[model samples]
Target: MVAALDVGGLGMDAQVSITARPEPISLDPRRTAVVVIDMQNDFGSRGGMFDGAGLDVAPIAALVQPISRVLETARRAGLFVVYTRQEHNSDLSDAGNEDSPHRIKHRRMNIGATVEAPSGIRSQILVRNTWNTAIVAELEPRQGDVVVSKHRYSAFFETSFDTILRAKRINTLIFTGATTSICVESTVRDATLPLHCT
Candidate 1:
């Protein structure tokens, strides 16, 4: 005869042991989406914003190849792929006083100031349509992929990210990108909110 399995919680005086089993989840590609966050030249390339500011790009650059592989695999599996880019207007009109401190600091350090990008556009770092704001070549978005531009760390803040996800009927999101503690984490936290998809 099989022994009875007590699956409920036991009190301190109880002396029973329980074994937990791992369950494998089958993912439906149609309902899943991959969110690639801020994998741009400004944060991952040499002579870019972060590098020009004396920040090491090696760590962030290391994620490129792996993320590219993931993008390829996800596309092959027919999963929706979305890329989020952080950028501001050339005239700094979109950036209010909230980012003034950072701008002032970078200006003081002679970094992140207006510079001539590879595209021949004279703009500050992460300016839209400039080379520094473009997604890295290794993981560029394909024809069917979606691209969202955001000015804040959290992609959901004043962005069409949620609307696009809902339009595609996406239920699960896999986030992959650079600077795990900042933009990536912020996006993840915001994505966890209850989405009221019509």
Candidate 2:
């Protein structure tokens, strides 16, 4: 009856113990959450944004059903659910802004942009915008779920996800969907709370 959860950048494992005369405690759905990563059209199924990065969407689409189920279940249980997607300025110049900090790294790394354009101005990654940065359509954002815009690979990095989680007192998180080796991995590496990744 014990489990680990991931909240923001902190990871904590909690075990529930049963006593002889235990007081049955009701679970608080308000303390739980689920984070879905990069469920957009470009990085998701069919016409994703990552196609230019030599990334494929067919595999990411497989999680559609599972992620949808998690969304529904978490909502019903009153758990705060969130999603993150990687997006950049259309001009690609803002990525290098000094104040934002990500502006520097994003400008240098250019995770979304694969190769320089033939003219040496843009990149092939800009063509689709659907593959590299777009969230899959099947698992689109809803009015209730928190949608976060991530400039870096990790959703927890330089994003408002943590702020909202704290505001809602969400402690536990379940992560599912898209780019297991990329965005998903990055999130797990940074998540500090107790979490169950399925």
Candidate 3:
């Protein structure tokens, strides 16, 4: 028989009982890294062009407090920290024309909500960097934090995230941030392996 898993921030936090388990979980600081995703103003709904997109960002905002606690733990353990942003250029030409590497579907509309910004994320096929694409302020990065720019949802796609982790001999990954069903899920699918974190 399998046990029901309690998930989400503070949802199943107190459910973990390692002492009752056969084998305890262990983490090796030298082999672990933290990957933070899309905690930007756009998603955080603080001061982005798409702030009025009609989605409640409070849940994510609340999650950040606990996530920051975990982040501090990672820092204390001397683990690596990586951040991802989905910002793209307005010209669409910055990534490419039709076959541009950036490949943002409605490039203009998403960035600061050009003309179609009022339309909401209806045709938001591809998203990229804009003035509001930086990570959220709650869990802001400290000095030496690795920042990566990703055109796609996965931070690993055609980016230096993998290279940097490998260079540091990082095998375990601690992923945290907003939009769990979208960006977070995408990263997990795109990642080459399983991630280990609290």
Per-candidate local distance difference test:
0.75, 0.60, 0.61
Q: Count clashes in each candidate, considering only residues at least 3 apart in sequence or on different chains.
A: 0, 34, 8
TM-score per candidate, chains pooled? 0.79, 0.64, 0.69
Compare candidates 1 and 3 on TM-score and give the better one: 1
- Model 2 local distance difference test score: 0.60
Error of 1 at 50 (Å): 0.2
Per residue, candidate 3 scores C-alpha lDDT tens digits across 76-159 of 656678888876655444355655534444344344244223225332212354435656767778998888887666787778
Off by over 4 Å in 3: 1-23, 94-109, 112-131, 193-198
lDDT of 2 by residue, 150-185 (tens): 767788777887777878876666677667887888
Greater-TM-score candidate between 1 and 2: 1
What lDDT tens digits, residue by residue, belong to model 1 across residues 1-198?
001223134343433232334743344556778889999988998867988778899999999988887777677656688999988877656655645854554454343357776666675687788788889988888999989998778889889998888888887777899779999998888888876333
**TM-score preference between candidates 2 and 3, better one:** 3
> Poorest 10 consecutive residues of model 1 by lDDT?
1-10
Cα misplacement distance, residue 155 of candidate 1 (Å): 1.0
Best by lDDT: 1
Backbone clash total for model 3 is: 8
Candidate 2, TM-score vs. the true structure?
0.64
